[model samples]
Target: MTFDLIIALATACVAFVLSKRSVAHFPLWRAVVTPLASIIGSGFLLLGPILNIGYGGYAPLIMIALCFVAFLFGGVIRFNMAAGEQAIQNGDYGALAIRIETLSSWALAFAYIISVSYYLNLLGAFALSLTPFNSDLDAKLLTTGVFFIIVFVGWSRGFKSLEKMEYVSVSLKLAIIAGLLIGLMAHFGHRALDDALIFNPPKLDGWSALTLAFGLLITVQGFETSRYLGSEYDAQTRIKSMRLAQWLSTAIYLVYILLISYVFRPDQMSSSETGIINMMQIVAPILPFLLVAAALASQFSAAVADTSGSGGLFAQLSRNRITERQAYLLLAVIGVALTWSANIYAIVNYASRGFAIYYGLQAALGAVIAARQNTGWQRVGFYGLLATLGAVIALFGQPVE
Candidate 1:
């Protein structure tokens, strides 16, 4: 009960602090919030258990590796933001850079399609987790309903009204995540003092483990959202905010994975979609409630963001041949199909592959720009390697079993 009270108090304090005008109104913070929110979305709810169950005590290490890979990808995007944009504006790279950029945008639009399904499906699962209607079919039906709502709202009213929910949702989700970390920390300390911490062996090894990590790329996929905030921020601001968002999210993820890895036995981790909620039931009674709240806010907001993004990208890339309304309808149809055809884990894999293809194209574009600009063989080689890696991940990444 003491721990529960502490967790509740911590959450309230963080929420209150985040709601203050100084923090809420800061320009850099506001810019940071978008990508940060997206980056930490449904992944926070799912990755802990997946990593803990799959990698055991080495989960934190795996988390670090995931973040590092994401940071490298982020570096590619950042370069494109700084240099590629200028080159395109000046017509310095001929049509090759322009072509790759177009292909990447199209890839991103498709990736967003998969990712919206990923977010809303998790939202449905978490929404029904504590209720009596807690089955796969129930979750799928709920997800389908939400898809329709998004489509209706988007087509009828536009997402401007719903997009405002992002700020509040980001604050609430971050505050709840703070509380979860505090609870996990206290639990971890207690276990350490009692010598009850467990360091289980990895359940996976070698090539299988490598491919699984590839599939999980979407867990760290949202940093690219920062690259698209051009209308709201300058190139420099976007680059700085993106770097900050990735760093902060990486820190949060590493701590969460580290704390959870040692505190729970392999058997104690739930294998279901809402497994984290059940696992948190042991950490503190308040934790499950807080987690569910965070899950709902983060997932819904992320879905809306991606849906809006997909619509805009499709409309732009198609030269308005596909209106944003038609794109929303297309997304709704595909999202529903995904919800019915695949489980959340499989959707996660598909989303990861989709994003990987987008990142690869971005990397390929970066390499072309670098080569044309005489940016040195080493930099060009790095980008080429990243492009190959992204392609490999897209081709070989497998779903979690």
Candidate 2:
């Protein structure tokens, strides 16, 4: 544990230095892709294991289903991206756009609250694991303080600052994930063939499977971060980057699930939120610290990015009546409240539902915009279909075990 703290603290110092250094301007890809740090953070570590915990050999099916819905969600965001750019460019957010933006902003803000809670819980778990003296309360308090500070600083400094640091955070996370995959493959060696063919029967019926798919929607929530990039980036770049992020995430998730599912029996992976840590611990003791550090870094980066996005949305929707700082302050307070009042899994449920609600609004707005632009019935029908799907998930998607 002492060694773990040393590694974590060293990692933190390196991150701090990276943040302080001058960063070059982002290219089109970098500009649009960096925000994905918010989406792909600790999620890469947790979501696959969570799916395995429930679906076992059937987890890949759920992953494919999730990828489909995520692409649909991406379509919803892409369709609406034009309207947002137009709103920014003309400084005339139409009545319908404003209404949609308002709804989406509020829903995303609530989702940010849940996300903050979940991030803090992950941080607390790490803190407790590393130190015998730290209680959950102590961990929460420490995390809450750090979270508020990051949100406030990021809001005051603006997206440009966040974008600058994003490359480091995103790279670190991706590297950690890649290293884990390599480590697992090396450890498995010839056992890979034996494990690859292992299968368990389906545990969920169709309705339950659908419910689980919707419930796991939070795993792809960050792709829509591109939706708000209009103020800083070109429309084409935003759309392209968003699609790239979605496809990239889908591929990464598929590989991650396959690798993890082979490592454990279906029943062996239960409902623990920290399944990644446990899995790593079983293979090699030193491995857990690396995963823990990655989780901490990823969660911190994600929380800051989302908090910044929510603050930007609130400031824009309010026409600057609420400054970004004030919006961030409000969000931080809400996040702190949610962190204290809710467990991590409950927060995950709320986060999933909140993003699902936002996706529904985006889909609805996409349909409306498609109608206005006379983009043809084909486009309209596609957007409408997505809207119906989002609405179904928003209204009836319950938390799945």
User: Cα miss at 392, model 2 (Å)?
Assistant: 1.7
lDDT of 2: 0.71
Clashes of each: 0, 0
Predicted candidate 2 versus true structure: per-residue lDDT over 223-296, tens digit per residue: 88877776777888888888888777777777777766656766456566666777777655666777877777
lDDT of 1 by residue, 91-120 (tens): 787788888898899999999999999999
- Model 1 quality (TM-score): 0.97
Which pairs, if any, clash in model 1? none
| Cα lDDT listed for each candidate | 0.89, 0.71
TM-score of the candidate numbered 2?
0.86
